[model samples]
Target: MTLFFLPIPVNSPLPDLTLADILERTIELSQTAAVILKSYYRGSPAQLEVIDKAEGPVTVADKAVDRHLLDGIQAMCGDSCGYLTEETYQAGDFQLPQDWVWIIDPLDGTRDFIDKTGEYAIHIALTYQHRPVLAVVAIPESDRLYAAIAGGGTWNITADGVRTPIRVTGGKELTKLVVVASRNHRSEGLVKLLAQLPCQQQLKIGSIGCKIAAILEDRADLYVSLSGTSAPKDWDLAAPELMLIEAGGKFTRQDGSLLKYNQGDVNQWGCLIASSGEWHQQILDACLD
Candidate 1:
């Protein structure tokens, strides 16, 4: 692991790190987090600690790893970046430290974590002008990391640091598409939408990161989110959206508009779809029409 993140005392002047520098450090922080999580699992008590938040279940690993990722990024940004994190974010505190913001979800699927499903992930994204400029989605259990920068293609990186360029599958046949759906959050509307897309295979999975990773790896062809009240926040979508789009996929609202982040409310409600881009309009028409 790289040692780019040096411990900085609170209230001291932060070191200046550009987006390029921050991206490298973010990857390192994620790698460190993967190790930290492994330790937590091994030292797991017979009944691990869990808490119910408004969004979903959170564990000790969620809070602790969130703090570490937030701190590591803050140490490099000085006062130039805002932060929206799942554990520490307060509703009104979405202040603009700067136009550039770091959206993070240190642990994305707490239920999957509790179930030992290895479907959880760590999400980190840098957004400017409401779109991601750099994104990293780290799946610790799989020992894989997916990252994308603006205008740069996405890559699938092994734990040993070998990287291979990745792209979405070209499965455009209406009768043969595979769709990955949320394991924990499902609604009637989602069922209807799935039913509408007749002949598409369905896969229920935890963590949006893992679901999108599946699309990029060609394990699945699409994923959809129809939020009802408990909508997904910016942290849920930012990192993986970049990964998918950079991999030649499409992520958008049901109407095919691009997803914009840090728009004050943070909740990404309503119908959102991610497809392989080969037949996105075809799927959109099937689900919407």
Candidate 2:
């Protein structure tokens, strides 16, 4: 029943908040999510577990960190905007405010987290008027984070705190492409689709945002998802969508349609592809065939 947003300021001078500031703060929140997740990981195994209404396992780390990130954003951005999150927002009860909104997934790869595979990540994306303008994807176990500020470009922070710019590699052929697919969400349709391709390699990773991060780093060439009746949530791809586009990559639905956010339905069903821009459409067509 609680609506989320930044409070409208009447008298106080507006802070000179920029996309960079938002990105920096989002990274900080991601680190916070990391700490929370790590705490659960190191705690008594029996105590850090949970079960959601959908019968999905919701570990202590997941809910705790989800609250932490949501609270963190609320504290920073206040009541002027709205919030949409994987763990908190109910589709029927909430509608996005007209101003800025946040789309978040506190623990994206929950299954991987439960298994302690270190492939999970926390996703934080900022949307203005329903389109992502700033985003952050943090992989705590690996000590890596990827961020983008609308036009600010994509950046990577190494485990040691070193920062580097990231971009998709240009002009790679389909035969030599290295695709990164979802570790747990892969569909039989996608497997059959890829089987027809002459791709050189594929890496199955957890989290859509995390997979996009791989593409941003050029570690893997592409990230593809074949959706079923249930589409991906807005929180699921909002950040990755902008981050990948700003990183000079292509992100679109399986049929090559552009993605739009704040559609009420969070799930993004259908074929989805993220590539370094050069061969994005080629991969889409191949998958469709």
Name the best candidate (by lDDT).
1
- Each candidate structure's TM-score, on Cα atoms with residue i matched to residue i, is 0.91, 0.88
**Each prediction's Cα lDDT score?**
0.81, 0.75
Candidate 1: C-alpha lDDT: 0.81
- What would the per-residue lDDT of candidate 1 be over residues 74-151, giving only the tens digit for each residue? 877856778888887787625454568889999998899888888999999988867888889999888999877766
For candidate 2, the TM-score is 0.88
Query: In model 1, where is the ten-residue run with the lowest total lDDT?
Result: 4-13
Which residue runs of candidate 2 sit more than 4 Å off their true CA positions? 1-15, 52-55, 91-94
Backbone clash pairs in model 1 (N, Cα, C under 3 Å; residues 3+ apart or in different chains), count: 0
Question: Using TM-score as the measure, which candidate wins?
Answer: 1
TM-score of 1: 0.91
Worst 10-residue lDDT window, candidate 2: 1-10
